[model samples]
Target: MTDTSTSSVPESTADATAAEPEATTAEETADGGTERPAADNKDLFRESEIAADYVEGLLDILDYDGDIDELTQGGRPVVEVVGARLQSLVGQRGATLEALQELTRLAVFRQTGTPSRLLLDVGGYRASRRKELAAVAKNAAEKVKQYGEAIKLDPMSAFERKCVHDVINALSGVESESEGVEPSRRIVVRPAS
Candidate 1:
């Protein structure tokens, strides 16, 4: 039987989902048989499919309209929901979006019996946030280089800290480190020397 749920979704979303590689694995199975790498790719795509369905259901329940795109990037499943007037789901600094992403990950885990490194984007929020965080990271790195001292930034999520760390590590005269605990964990930029 064919699934009719996607009938209402936009054609762009359908195309995006179709564009992902089928899942397959490269490891040997318990039966001493080599599994195809395509299996892993298919698994990742399946995770995206599950995540997309969950997110679509959520949008429907909330009376929100969006074009959902499910695809794999950087070896991980990514689901993107794009639409107008969807800011409420994104919340302040995308806190709500983060929560929803975790929920979708859990859903994938429950279905696939494997933990998912799924990334969910709502209303292009993550892309915008990444750009903003990159700028913040550069500024912090600059401050460290100019002051010749350690600079502690405001606490940020793990993803945000990673962004800053990547920027600082790429620079010549500065390094970045994470300190403190969750919700309070932040990045510290220090002179390389």
Candidate 2:
């Protein structure tokens, strides 16, 4: 397993982790909107390193060969695994991937004592899924606009729902909202009033 760092390494992961909690405290801004200090790049990079190490260990135990990339993207730690014959890690509808991501986040939290917003992607599944979800959102929006009625989408994961919501929000004439609970949560698109 190879680890790649996209940002400058901190003097110590421990030092970065220790300073994270204080930076996360919410404070009122001039406009009355609550704001929190942006996570330091070093801290975020350390999170990616931790997550990558955890994932590397799992791959070793499973005897899988893959290249792991660790980096920070959009203010969150991201780990991407790219290789052949890794479909099992991705699982059906990315269920296993999501589970693994949560496990990786837990590993980071155990060491840092702070929750991590870590994104783990296997075999480019998320990128392709995002495109598919965008098409689904556009189709649903079209149906709602034409029929002047609501269109209910199938149950989806939070990531999938967010993708759909993004597309719906970018388009006109339709609005979207999520309803139901986990494992059954879905998005509904309706003609904007």
Candidate 2's displacement at residue 141, Å, is 0.4
Q: Write the per-residue lDDT of candidate 1 for residues 73-192, one digit (tens) a residue.
A: 866789999999899988766667767877898999999987677878888887887777778777766766676777767755555555566667678988766655444545567778
Q: Score candidate 2 by lDDT.
A: 0.72
- Model 1: worst 10 consecutive residues (lDDT sum): 12-21
Model 1's alpha-carbon lDDT is 0.66
Q: Write the per-residue lDDT of candidate 2 for residues 1-193, one digit (tens) a residue.
A: 0111112111111101111111111121111123335798899999999999999999999999999999998777899999998999988777688779879989999999987878899999999988988888887888788878787677666677667778888999988776554445556787787
TM-score of 1: 0.78
Highest lDDT: give the candidate number.
Answer: 2
Model 2: runs farther than 4 Å from truth?
1-37
